[model samples]
Target: MTVPDSLADADGLATFAVATVLGFEDFGADAVVEAVRKSLPELADEYGEQVFAQLSSALRGAEGDGASPWSRRTRWPSLEDRVQRMERVEYAQLCRVRDALTLLVEASPALALARRAGVENSDVRHIEAVRALNRRTDEYLRRAEAVSRYPAERAWKGFTGLLLHVCSSPGRLSTFQQDVTVLDPALNDVPGLGRRVLARCMAASDGEA
Candidate 1:
């Protein structure tokens, strides 16, 4: 099976959300709550409370109407709101809020897959854009030193890294793609690397060796 293309892909995100919910139904909500709490202690007085409330609600796994946890429409508004609010807050405050939110999203399938692939929370903390998720995926593989010349393994590692680097860092994408061109000719433009990588992660998470 293949992984989802991106977190923004509605179907992909939805599938991930469902998979995550089914997989981690037993997870305590306390971690989510604590992430917010630990982050808030250092926020500037003016915006700390507001950011806390927004993040808390977003991570609570329930909508205002008591529906599902991460309906794209419901979750984005809250996340977007926090993002916009952070712009007006102090730098430290913004960092804290971002950290808290990032931690919460880790419970989602998108980041969960990264974790399953062996990425730690710290690995994703520096993501500045949505594309960073893909970049981080590549980093996970690279850190594992799992890149190989075999068709399946090399295509999986190098190509996924290429896709991620291209998505997250567009300016550097050209150079990276060129580098990848020298490495794996088969993965020129499949457009399904994300899905493929995600599938690999799912398998790994299920303890498949």
Candidate 2:
């Protein structure tokens, strides 16, 4: 099946759920956000803009019950409404991602990949949800990395900075851990690269514990 149809495509959904979780566990939310942001380009302008708006706006909405992207999931929220709901949606989505990531870290890779596919909806472009996302993420990372003229430090920081911001949360370490595993270690600016995210998650867990 084509990329758009892959949302309902069983194989594609399965892979995405696993991979998204895998990405979260290993890479963190900023990385996941980076990955999702990277994938957003494939969403087409209107929806892409709306979705991205929701992602950012929603993250902010978490400051209050001000209706975030997920909260705005009425039959069809307007672009503005979707933007309002972004924070709630982000919270829910991030939690789901964390749960998924936590599972991958705990279980075998085969089991992680074998779970049943969730009911993933296609984005405005109508590609299978996860497939479309994964496609865009890979493309974004590649495009960002293809800066031939930029110095090595600039190029590397460009991508890593994106990962750190988008994936960061109060105390979620999984995303950070996974990201550093893949990031260039030569750069020293990011001491204990994922430390901030790790600290955030560790603090949360400690509070709960």
Among the numbered candidates, top TM-score falls to: 1
Q: TM-scores of the models, in the given order?
A: 0.24, 0.21
Under the 3 Å rule for N, CA and C atoms, how many clashes does model 1 have? 4
Q: What is the C-alpha lDDT of each candidate?
A: 0.39, 0.37
> lDDT value for candidate 1?
0.39
Per-model tally of clashing residue pairs: 4, 27
Q: Write the per-residue lDDT of candidate 2 for residues 116-200, one digit (tens) a residue.
A: 2221211112222222445433332333334323577885565444333233422222333433223222122223323433454
TM-score of 2: 0.21
Candidate achieving the largest lDDT: 1
